[model samples]
Target: MSTTFWIIIAGAIATYLTRIGGHLVISRFDNIHPRVEAGLNAVPAAVLTTLVAPELLNAGPAEWAALVVTAVVSLRGGLMAMFLAGAAVLILARQFVG
Candidate 1:
């Protein structure tokens, strides 16, 4: 196999093993450490903030409104709901505000 092909296979196998290892570790734990639990809980918010923070800093009004809608939806809804709400708000904001 080519070196690049071997690299890709190695990456895929590493990803699969890491995911399975997490499951195996969690299954053995009757209760996770509080700090570990807290870190896990913070991951989604941290990821969302990282994703949105740059856009927020540079956003025009419509983008700002869309982000606000997303935040609100995130509080009371799931990811898909928040995404849809944000997209809908963006569409409307563009149509009306532009």
Candidate 2:
């Protein structure tokens, strides 16, 4: 109906095509190369770094406390535990720090 709507539709179609194309290509291969598999495994860490690095530049006490707790939890717990601990610390710290 509008330019923005058309742009959103185009983007959705593009995203779907890329996802399907990747799946099709991967399915055709009998086995993946170890290097490629390692690269794929590293994607999550790279993406997380990209997301968190910028936030650290503008973080406050609450954010720092959450990050510290998250790091500590990550060293000895599962992902869910780390996330929950970080979120709880952030919320509780904000209540007092703000």
lDDT of 1 by residue, 23-87 (tens): 88887989889999999999878997898678767788899999889989898999899999999
Q: 1-98 in candidate 2: lDDT tens per residue? A: 99999999999999899789878888899999999999988988999899999999999999999999999999999999999999999999999987
Worst 10 residues of 1 by lDDT: 48-57
Quality of model 1 by C-alpha lDDT: 0.90
What's each prediction's clash count? 0, 0
What is the lDDT of every predicted structure here?
A: 0.90, 0.95
| Candidate with maximal lDDT | 2
Q: Which candidate is the best by TM-score?
A: 2
Q: After superposing candidate 1 on the true structure, give the runs of residues whose Cα lies further than 4 Å from its correct spot.
A: 1-14, 26-32, 96-98
Model 1 clash number: 0
Query: Model 2, which residues run further than 4 Å from truth?
Result: 1-22
- Candidate 1 collision pairs: none
